[model samples]
Target: MALIRKIIKTSSNEHYPFSVPVIENLKELDLEQDIIIFSGENGSGKSTLLEIIALKLNLVRISLDINYSDPEFSDLKAAINAFTVEFSLKPNGFFFRSEDFISYLRYLNKTKVEAEKELKRIETEYREKSAYSKILASMPHKRTLNELDNLYQRNLEEQSHGESYLDFFKSRLRPKNLYLLDEAEVPLSFQNQLTLMVLIKNAVAEGCQFIISTHSPVLMAFPGACIYDFNQEVIKEINYEDIEAVNQLRNFLNDRDRYFKYLFD
Candidate 1:
């Protein structure tokens, strides 16, 4: 598959004229990897960087902020508005922050409204044609239609937060596009994070590119991923075993009794 080849950033320092400037250092980074992981502590500008890249690439950006209608949403909306005004880019992304799940459920409910409208339309047509044909012939496909409606309702009922997150990805992501995901592991467990990694690999193989900001050790462990550590202020190629979280986890697991004895004893 054809890769991004390069992402040149005009300013690595935030002090540049633009809040986030254009890409300038394309020669320094590799663009052929299946996944790119951004690791950082809170307030490390990881999300900001991802947003800037999303604007530049005209890709859909998904993050935990998509579900909320609070001050964060307003701030993000302002940034998106500013970015769109500054750059001629179309709105192709969906924001699914934690609070945004309610909005998604509302959207799914619209399918029920649409299905009802279709049922009404079909009933009217059937009644209108009943006079010209056998009543049996104009009985209409109500059973199948009702079954579909029930199926959609069941889906809405079964939409756990994780499932909803996955649903959004499955429905909104298209081939040959860019995806900026911030802490996508928020709704996924360790096992699900691994599943998501596989999906990301498959997507990358199919010509989709992703820039993800996350703290999940499982996600950070994606094979052949490029990791940037905001805490260290360095972009280095490292395996998951080298990540602080993984090392911490390993240390605790290796000497659980010793570590627990300090508190318990």
Candidate 2:
């Protein structure tokens, strides 16, 4: 392994993540593939396990402005210390949580709005002042706008939510790092999810590794990626076709009217 080699739980305290059945099980997981995925339904422990791993690795969150030290994460912070992770190399990466994306988007838009308001105020207040004074007064707001523009060169808010999500991911994406993502496909449409898969494939080709926790069957279809089914009683690696999401999707497509009838009745 070029990065983390394994993860082991050294203590037996029934803490938050530890209290979860699948996470509480004693074990070590060896890293073999560059792309690892955790697949399961909600509360099946996929997202929680990924979060603990991200904490162990000390990776930055993809959606910025989150305070990890907040009281809400206190239990997870303590729980992570019980695990000992073996590393072949200190890995670099970001932990992306879908739930945080919208908040991040709002932050960006809010900053831009504030800057615009300041610039407008400066223009009105400095109308009768010397050109140099006006320029100096407006410099800070202009600089803020410039830095925001450099982020994506387009107004993210102007795009559809799905478009903005992809743009944000692309802007933050870098090579030769690991990415831990939880349900990144939430905002994407069926077609956009495939686009995201292509992006992941290209990044992996450039030495990036990913450990994603997702319910999307399209993501689970990544070729040669190692997938663990959290839906199982124990954490177990499984094939694509055998994944519950994949099977359920296939069933729905095969008998769409049948499903609608059952739901309606």
Best model per TM-score: 2
- Give lDDT: candidate 2, residue 116: 99
Worst lDDT 10-window in candidate 1: 17-26
TM-score for each of the candidates: 0.63, 0.90
lDDT of 1 at 175: 70
TM-score of candidate 2 against the unseen true structure: 0.90
**lDDT score, candidate 1, position 188:** 79
Tens-place lDDT digits, model 1, residues 216-244: 88888777777876554444556677778
